[model samples]
Target: MLENYLVRGLLIGIVFGVPAGAVGILSVQRVLSQGAAAGLVTGIGSSVADVFYACIGVFGITIISDFLLKNQHIICMLGCMLVILLGIQCFRKKKVEKPASVSHKKQEDRHQPGTIRYLISCFLSSFAIAITNPATILSFMVVFSMFRIGGNESIGEDIQLVLGIFCGTCFWWLLIAVVVSHIRDRVTDGFYLKLNRIFGILMVLFGAGIGVRAFMV
Candidate 1:
C-alpha cells in the first residue's frame, strides 16, 4: 500500500509539477521586487498550497469544489484586476540597449529576472493568482483522482501521495530557479524593464477580457 501510493503519487507529481513550473516560475518572475528570490519563496509557498489541494482532492472535498464553482466569476474578476496592475507596471519602464552591433542574435532574449524577491513575489501572488484561473484546481483534481492512492486511499496513503507531489513540485521549482538565476546575470536592466512592459500590457488585456467575460456570464 505504501509503495503503491508512493510510486503513483511520484509519477503524477512529476507529470503535473514539471509543466506547472513553467507557468509558476514565469508568474513569479514577472513582479520582481527581486525576481529570482520572489520566484523561489513564492514557488515554495505555492508548492505547499499545491500539496494541500492535492490532499483535498484525494480526500473528496466536493463541497469546497462546489463552492469554488459558485464563485468562479468573482475569481475571474480578481484575476483581471491583477492583470491590470501588471499592465500599468510594464509600460512605466524604458527600453533596453541595442543588440551586439545590431547584427548579432541577442534581441530575442533580454532581462533574465535575477532579483530573487521578484520571482518569489510572483510565486506568492500566484497562490491566489493561479487559482483565479479556475482550471488550475480542476487540473489537480483530475490528476490526483486518477491515481486513487491507497486501498480506498486511506489517510496515510493519501498523505503519501501529497508528499510525492510536493517533492515533484520542488524538483520543478528548483530547476527553474537555477536556470533563471544563471542567465539573469547576463541580461541588462533595460531589457528587464521592456519585458515587464510587454508582459504588463498583455496581462491587462487578458485580465480585462476575463472581467468582461464574467460580466457576460
Candidate 2:
C-alpha cells in the first residue's frame, strides 16, 4: 500500500513537471548560459514549491485552496505579467561571447555573485510563479481523487508520497539540465539569441491569452 501511494505520487509529479511552460524555458536558458549546476539548482527550487502545493492539496487546506482558486484571475494576470517581463529581459540579453582564455572565464565567474544568491533568486521567482498558478493544486486534487485518496492516511504514507514527488521532479529537471548542458557547447550564439526571442514571444502570447480570458469572464 505504501509503495502504491509512492508510485502514484511519482507519476503525478512527473505529469505536473513535464509541461514546457515559461519556467521550463527559463531553466533551459539558464542552463545554456550559466551551466548545468545553476540550472539544476533553479529547478530544485521549483520542485520544492511543487511539493508545498502538493502538501496543501493532500492535506485538504480548503481555506487557502479556495482563496487561491477564487482569485485565480488576478493571480494568473500577475503571473503572466511577470513571465512576460522575464521573457523580454531574456530576449534583450546580449549573446554570450567566448572568452579567449581560461583565466578570463574564471575571472568572469569570480565577478558574479555566488551560487547561493543565484539559487535564492531562482527559488523565490519560481515559488512566486508556482503559487500563483492555482491550477497546480487542482491538478494534485484531481490526481489524488483518481487514486482514491481519502486524506486519512497515516503520516508514514504522506511522507512516502512527498518523497516520491520530490524525487520525480528532481529526475525531470536533472534530465533537462544535463541534456541542455551537453549541447551547450555546440549551440551557436545566434541560436541562443533566437531561442530567447522565441520564448519571449511565447510568454507575451500566454500573458495576452490570460488577460483576455480574465476580462472576458
Candidate 3:
C-alpha cells in the first residue's frame, strides 16, 4: 500500500514538473547563464513549493487550501507582476563574455560567498513564483483524487507519498541541470543571448496568461 502511494506520488510529481512553464524556462535560463548549482537550487525551491501543496492535498488541509483558493486572484496578480518583471530583467540582460579559460571558468563556478548569495536569490525567486500559483494545489488535489490517494490513509502512507513526490521532482530537476550544464560550455554568447530573450518573451506570455486566468476566476 505504501509502495502504491509512493509510485502514484512519483508519477504526479513528474507530470507536474515536466511542463515547460515559467519555472521550467527559468531553470533552463539559469543553467545556461549561471551554473548547474543555480539551476538545481532554483528547482529545489520549486520542489519545496510542490511539497507544500502536496502536503495540503495528501493531508487534506482544508483551511489553508480554502484560504488560498479564496484569495487566488490577489495572489495570482502579484505573481503575474513578479513574473513580468523577471521577464523584463531577462530580456534586457547584457550579453556575457565567454571565459577565455575553460578551466578557470569551471573553477569560478564553484561555490563562493557571492555565488551562495546568488543561489539564495535564485531559490527564493523560484519559490515565490511557484507558491503563488494556487492552481498548484488544485492540480495536486485532482491528481490525488484520480489516484484515490487521500482517504482514510495512514499518516505513514501520506508521509511516504510526499517524500516520493519530493524525490521525484528533485530527480527531474537534477537531470535538467546536468544535461543543460553539460552543453553550456559549447553554447556561444550570441546563442545564449538569443535564448535569454526568447525565454524572457515566453515567460512574459506565461505571466499574461496567468493574469488572464486570474481575471476569469
Candidate 1 or 3, higher TM-score? 3
- Model 1's TM-score against the true structure: 0.72
Cα lDDT listed for each candidate? 0.62, 0.76, 0.86
Give the alpha carbon lDDT tens digit for every residue of 1-217 in model 2: 8998798778877876784677787778778877776678768878887898888887778998888888888887887777778778877876563222236657467436674687678777766666667777888888788878879988888888888888888888899889988988887877877877887777667667766755653
- Backbone clash total for model 1 is 22
Off by over 4 Å in 2: 97-113
Instruction: Between candidates 1 and 3, name the one with more favorable lDDT.
Output: 3
TM-score of each: 0.72, 0.87, 0.93
- Please tell me which predicted candidate would have the highest TM-score against the true structure: 3
lDDT of 1 by residue, 1-217 (tens): 7777877777877787763422453443432324354456556666766776676577777787777767888887887787576567556755443233233343333344443444446656656555665545678877755664323767777778778888877776677666766666565776666666666666667668878976765
Please report the candidate that would top lDDT against the real structure. 3
Model 3 compared with the native: what TM-score?
A: 0.93
How displaced is residue 171 in candidate 3, in Å? 2.0
lDDT of 3 by residue, 1-217 (tens): 7888788778877877773678888998998887788889999989999999999988889999999999999999998998888999889987673333246866677576876898899999999989989888989878888878756889988988898889889888899999998999999888888988998999999999889988999
* lDDT for residue 82 in candidate 1, whole number 0-100: 72
Error of 1 at 7 (Å): 3.0
Better of 1 and 2 by lDDT: 2
